[model samples]
Target: MPPLNYGTFFANFNLEMIRPFFKERIAFRRKAPRRMPSLAFTTLPSLLLLGSFTFFLAPPARARLTFHPTIYEEKADYLDTQTVAVYHFRNEGDKTVTIRKVRASCGCTVPQLDKRVYLPGETGVLRAFFAFGSRSGKQEKKIRIWTNEKDLKKPYELILRTEIPRAVRFSPIFLHWGRGDTPITRTVNAWVEADSPVKILSIDEPAPDFSVRLQVLKPGRGYLILVTPRDTAKPKMRRIDIQTDFPRKKPLSYSIYCSIR
Candidate 1:
């Protein structure tokens, strides 16, 4: 070790300091050749693994249960003895579901569910039968189904309506005459039409105190039925049945309500 010039000493010191850096650079270059391409390929697989993990950890979506003919109905005009069929429903979800029960608004309306548990992508049938015996005018009915799914708890609904036409024309469908505890006389006006001439075979009331009289306002034109209650009758609600025969037609029956008060 001899005394050295300032520049020479400085140069040696710098070379010594940079020697390890150069070796590290060379080692890194050799170890990581094609770094960008390798890193890109490695990054894609890592991202895919992360995505798969996330997918496996996620919860599945809930199943949805539904009805076909979401609404079922019977019209008021349907014959009293007629039965209407409510078609089946299709399930569009990916899981199994069940309809626990089927119900109707009234005994006149009956409901039938084919099966309780339904497989994914299957069809289920529900039939509603309505018995309209002696029922007239506008009517409404409903069908409700209970299900396991929360969203479909109140699952089904149906509507029905009815309309009736008269075979003979009359000013009032119902008539109240004479005196009770309340008003003496009250009348309801109604009209009837038929394809052919119709006649009033007979008029009768179950209560002896209530009487009905048919007046031929115009021969073959139409008739008015005057209902009269005896003055001694007490105030009460009553119904009267009217029976008539038409030429070449089935016997007809009509009912009227009277409020004596």
Candidate 2:
């Protein structure tokens, strides 16, 4: 106690103070059997699974042009030589697009567009002019368009359909006979469409090798032509013209082919 071991006294005092704190911590840990799980380990797999489902199952967003009423159908008059088809479209995308080309299925159908480039939300029109040009009955045409859209695998197609009325129709316009066959007469039938009635006026003089006669089944509506080869001894061919009274810039005419083979 006189010179007193001060170092030993301080060491023993520090050990007594820390020992109780460590003892309490150890007793608390021993009383708890299971530790609380980490939120990271528990929720990470669920979040990962939800993210995978959203990535795989969600529909992709497309940025491209859109067309309204992609198909058009109309009835063309009998006298109409040409008609126009209109298509309205818009750039329903986030970026600008440029139309590369426009093509038609046939030469008679011509496609027209105003400009090549279009901005987002901008709209435009495409017109296709189809010329009948002696074409009749039901007609179908397709116009294809190419664009610089990233996801476009094939060209966009626009369809045009129309039924053209015919002024006249002929059945069996061609008649033929074998070289050594019977010289029997073959009949040709001609009828006018109800919408456009035309009278069969007269027949042009046929070749000397054939004989032609016309009998009007119904005046201005229907007719029958009887044709016979004068002689089937040798090969010969003749075209007989049937004149119609249908008023036009040039008189309407139809032809029948007669051949001996």
Candidate 3:
């Protein structure tokens, strides 16, 4: 016998089952006063065969790697000089995948992975270490990842978001005096922005031409620094350091600028 054509067989089978309905429809139309169109009924068999052939020849599904959460958020305390962010993911496709590279947005963030290759249905974790150093306020880091999967045109990006607390927030960190100007005392306001209590340990002595003093406004919650120039006849510049008891290893320090022209 000749080779069997599945598409033709299916089309012929369906047409046999639907032939009774088609005959009834035609008989009813013939008895009616007006004649209905027959183009759709005539072309339906060809369309059905084409659809069946296309469906049988379709391509297989591609592999896909998915993450539980693409974005992560956290709140960092003042004592935490460094923080780690974790991203959990798994291969959900039939093919195995290999992570070619992981790139971080900045040098302050380092990405780490246990291995490069992962089999189908395997799980993995991507960790990023962010060094706060002297950074404060809201911070965000982006990580781009590459894989051996071909279906994906662009690399996947993961976001790391954090809010770092400030030990003390200072306003007007700099004070200046113009030449021949009157020597007046200026005040710098300091507000405790950390969750824990932070006290002003001491204020270092400024240059001989400038004097500095610290006063408590709300105990550990707030304070004020008073700076004055003994004489503004000569130009002078100085940086006054304010010590705090945040942490020994990563102590928090505040500084203010003073200058006379």
Candidate 4:
């Protein structure tokens, strides 16, 4: 993925609008060399016009909002079910600003604010809750803020970054063994981070040709499961499922593949 250059958007906008104004000013300056005193008198009107144009292009300081930190970062553990991220901003402008709407990029992130409007010199905090249902690893989210700041054409973008450490993971979910050959044993390793603790409920029932044995390295979370061929005399195939105590409404049962030929 490519990094986003947010400044380019506004830079292009300002350049396009100011180009014509500068073009006319340059033409007047070139003609002034031909007539000194008459051009001197004539340039006053152009100078006034230039000043007025500058005033029109000046940034609106009367309707501005200042964010303390535009981006919020969170370092979270893999087992964390939910976490709250907060951002603080102040209405630095002299005029009151009304928040038209606040939107988030992901459904798992929800933004909460007290009201829709903010008085001048008032401060507002945005609380966004990130629900880590079954997600892991580094995640980035976006929040768009729309306000009645007349000068702004688009909503301001705020970034939310969350880093979730992968605490638990399974090696290979699928395994196979050749049939009519020497019955060999296959192994499945369940690794858990030293910080996070979890318990293994059971290895769900396997196929008739495959038998399983579970060994615990750590009392609660770590385990080594051995799978052996019960009868490899003929061709057979089986899909073995394993169960755990992980709390997920979505039935996220782990599985393995076994085949003999």
Candidate 5:
């Protein structure tokens, strides 16, 4: 201060000017620590919102289904005078379903399905009855089922076939004939209602013990045939041939086979 040094004076003045800047920097550094907790709290809410949004956006799981007897009635066969039953079809789908109808390719096969609606994981039954009474050898039949399922577009089919023996079958076909041992005497007794006029042209017997007689109750209207067997006649099989004079149905034949002791 006594020598009045100008360079030293200017340096001292610059140091005083920079000292306020240092103080301000230190104050800002001290305030940074207080801001850390507020910054942390603000970021936590944003992170929680992001996590909730991600969870809700995920896709849902898919439903599943199962079917019982997906392929059924693999094989079915029968013989003459044999009654065949087809195994029932069962469903195990995840959703409810209904069976609309059941049908057969031929009159020989009769099919019946459960008419009630089936619920999820429920089962239904289908029965097929085959009558081989008059059916002869080498026959093939089909049973079709219609259902209300989203997956199935057309009716499902079950196939049945058989190699039948060459034998004659009677119209009064059953386990036990409704009538007793007494033979049918009148043609009217053996007649059945028919849409077209049926006439018996001729009768034949394969075995000596078996015999047949015919009469026309009404011309071009109806007729009756009498089937008789001798007391000592032990016939293994019997057959009868009927000829109709009508051209619509040229000829119709009826036959029967039975075991006599």
Candidate 6:
């Protein structure tokens, strides 16, 4: 920046190595000391370097694979377990293309490709596996695909959308034990298949006339409840509110009715 001193910059080079251009630049600057020095000498050296970096910045190349459901968005009434959503894609290009790798947004989601390479017009399936262990509500996931497409440095993002419902199904919400019949324990099973493992947090407090116990077939997902009337002698009504860990608006509760007839 301080006027490039040839003696300091080109000190290592021998005097005989000096080009005619450097001599011409020195003579021209000497003659016009009052005028601004031309930076043309520096521009010429830059041109020589530009030859090494002459890659033309161009548009992004075309993709070889075309997906059937380009964007996967589906609503599930209930996603009880880890689910895999598959996307069908074909090599639309005339040439073969290799899939280098497939990645997902999170560890909970994984992308699976059958093979590395695919021939032209060959169909391939991309399976996106989503694990919803204890999560509920609307879930959105993304999968990034890397391929051998020319000039394609950035990966393609595939979007996935799912809606998980608050899933707790009770076979019979209402139970009755007749007065004349011998009192026997009645069972109600609460089956839950959900991203969030559901377990009964607690049952509503003290119903003196009723006896209730819970049985867990599968830790969080499946539950069996035993409800018995203390004595089926008189008419008695007990309100059994079942609470679960499943995500819900408030209280996170399911209701069951118990009555003595």
At residue 63, candidate 6 shows an lDDT of 82
- How far off is model 3, as Cα RMSD? 15.8
Put down candidate 3 lDDT per residue, 54-108, tens digits, no spaces. Answer: 9999986554778757888999976788889999999898888999999999899
lDDT of 4 at 233: 88
TM-score of each: 0.57, 0.69, 0.63, 0.56, 0.37, 0.43
Worst 10 residues of 6 by lDDT: 51-60
For model 6, residues 19-77, the per-residue Cα lDDT tens digits are 88799999988898585657797777788678655544444467878887857776665
Off by over 4 Å in 6: 1-60, 167-261
Give lDDT tens digits, candidate 4, residues 1-261: 888678986666767788999999999998887645687678998999999999999865443777757788988854477778888889888888899999999999999998878888899998888888756778999889999898877887888898876555667666776667778788888886535366667776575768888899987578888889887888887777777655443323556677887
Error of 6 at 232 (Å): 43
Model 3 accuracy (lDDT, Cα): 0.88
The sequence of per-residue lDDT tens digits that candidate 5 reaches over residues 19-76 is 9899999999988865356867889999999999989997643322233333333232
Residues 32-60 of candidate 1 have per-residue lDDT tens digits of: 85735687789999999999999999877
Local distance difference test, per candidate?
Answer: 0.64, 0.87, 0.88, 0.78, 0.55, 0.80
Off by over 4 Å in 5: 1-82, 167-261
lDDT-superior candidate, 1 or 3: 3
Residue pairs with backbone atoms closer than 3 Å in model 2 (clashes): none
Of candidates 6 and 1, the better by TM-score: 1
In terms of lDDT, the poorest run of 10 residues in model 5 is: 169-178
For candidate 4, what is the lDDT?
Answer: 0.78
Candidate 2 lDDT over 80-123, as tens digits, reads 78989999999988899999999999999999999999999999
Which pairs of residues have clashing backbones in candidate 6? 80-193, 80-194, 134-196
Colliding residue pairs in candidate 4: 179-261
